[model samples]
Target: MMARDPIRLWLNAHLGLVYVFLYVPILVLIALSFNKSGLPTAWTGFSTEWYGKLVANPKILSAAGNSLIVAVASTIISTVIGTLLAMGLEEGRSNPWLDALVAAPMIIPDIVLAIALLSFYTLLNMSLGLHSIVLSHAVFNIAFVCMVVRTRLKNFDRSIVEASIDLGASELTTFRRVTLPVIAPGVVAAALLSFTLSIDEFIIAYFTAGAGQGSTTFPMQIYAMIRFGVTPEINAIATIVIGFSFFLVLLSQRLNREAAP
Candidate 1:
């Protein structure tokens, strides 16, 4: 048997504590979602009635639909724009200021970005709705996607691109056949990350959404519900949302690992 390393053991213990700290509350929440008692400290029994209520709630259904629309639309737009932007920047000389500008949205606080977006929209007299939320989400999503793709590009082999071009293939065709395949994993990861963030986003959506029930995203709806205090139904909704975000992030991590050299 090999000798045990004290440092490794210590690190493992620390990591275990960190995971417990982060996920114990979420695990408790999940358990409580099905609690028949619907009490925080006591668990009478397990029941899925709250989940059924979630399905029957019209307001929640509408808000979920709105979130899906914003997430899908923003993911598509951000993935395309961000991928192209990352490619452009990678092909050009490095500029620190330009890099910072590209990443500013992700670095800045969400509330600040939300307020700025709201101001910009009001100044332009743009009608606020799901579309507005989509646009605002796309702003941060683009930055995140760009950052992820850029990491993939950092280790990219330029020779493949040059070879494809030298074979009389047009730039677009080369990108479709060669460049895109190499970066496909990163693109997928970025898209998933964007979708997850957009779906869970509250502040930006709250600020940019129109003044009506029609524009309420799921997170916004959850916030409104929270004002009335937590219930089994709210717990169920939170569990579902947290589960979805966790899944997407896990998938993104997997993709990123696959893309690693």
Candidate 2:
């Protein structure tokens, strides 16, 4: 057995502390969501009253509906475009500039992108609403989806494509029969990832949501609630959102692992 180094022990201790610091608030929020009193500091008993309240809130429900529309639309657009981009980059000659351009959405600051998109929409006189949010969310979602699919593609065997061609299979036939099956898991992972990101996105949505209650998304609604005060209902909503995001991320990770060796 390797000896435990003192430096390694110290590093691990610091890392543990960092993780605790990061997740302690989330743990507290989740725990508070079960409080019967709906107060953060006081927990009379365990209850799901706040969750029920969240369900009954029309504004929250409306926002959730808008969020679902945007997430679904963005996921569909991002997954298709991103998968094609990944395939093109993987099969065709690499262009450094093109790669950089594709990656810019992922690398750029959210506020910067949000403002830029808002400005562009304004200049184009585009009506800002759920559609605008969908378009904006797709910009980054596409990059994320492409990156995920590209990871799966990296481990792909090019010889399979060559073998298909050698067998006189058309490109479309080979892609449908072989390439698609190989990449299906990656596609699912990418779609889940895109959906999660679109659901959680706020800055761009806020900027492009325009002056209507019709386009308000769940994240924007949550932000509005947060500005007022933290309530047990907010905690419950947050817990649900966190759980949903966690589930999607776990699903994506599992699919990605399956797509790997």
Candidate 3:
């Protein structure tokens, strides 16, 4: 039997510690979701009471519905615009200003953007509701979607597109039948990632959601619950949100990997 190297053993130990440090709290939260006592300190026994309560909570249900609406709307807008932007930018020679402008949303402080957007809406007298939230979410979602699609496009074979054009296909036809199919996986990945981000976003949504429960999203509800205090139901909801985000991100990663080769 081969002996393990000391350096490798040490590195493995450190990596394990890092992983525990990052995920221990999440694991605890998930475990607590099944607690019968509804207290973090005492687990009493495992039960699905919290999950049942989560489903029965009208406020939570309403907020979740609103979040779904915002996520779907933002994902659709972001995917379409972001994919087109990536294709347009990639087709042309690199322009530093354009690149910076495209990336600005991802880098800018969320709070700052949120406030600026809120102020702009107020100035224009635009009503604050689902539409405003969708628009606000789309700004960052577009940046993320564009970045993901652009990464896929960077490895794209442009020769195929040129060949299609050379073979008497119009540019639109070539893009539709040839280029799009190749990038479909990347598009799906980007849309999923954008939807996840939009669903979980709070700071921007809080600022832009304006005055009412009508536009309250799931994250906003979570924030309110956290502020009041932690409860078993909150734990269950958190577990669900975390699980959904993880699933979407994993799917995105898988799609991107599949698109690669």
lDDT of 2 by residue, 5-61 (tens): 877898999999999999999999999999999577688999999999988999999
RMSD of each: 1.9, 1.5, 1.9
Ten-residue segment with the worst summed lDDT in candidate 3? 1-10
Model 3 residue runs over 4 Å out of place are 1-4
> What TM-score, over all chains together, does every model reach?
0.95, 0.95, 0.96
Between prediction 1 and prediction 3, the one with superior TM-score is: 3
Q: Rank all candidate structures by their TM-score, best first, as comma-separated numbers.
A: 3, 2, 1
Kindly provide the TM-score of model 3 when superposed on the true structure, using C-alpha atoms: 0.96
The ten-residue window of minimal lDDT in model 1 covers: 1-10
Q: What tens-digit string does per-residue lDDT give for candidate 1 at 1-261?
A: 245687788889999999999999999999999989866547899899989989999999999999999999999999999999999999899999999999999999999999999999999999999999999999989999999999999999999989999999999999999999999999999999999999999999999997999999999999999998888778899999999999999999999999988
Q: Model 3 clash pairs?
A: none
Residue-level lDDT tens digits of model 3 in 68-181: 999999999999999999999998999999999999999999999999999999999999999999999998899999999999999999999999999999999999999999
lDDT against the true structure, per candidate, is: 0.94, 0.94, 0.94
Candidate 3 vs. truth: CA RMSD?
1.9
lDDT of 2: 0.94
Local lDDT at 187 for model 2: 94
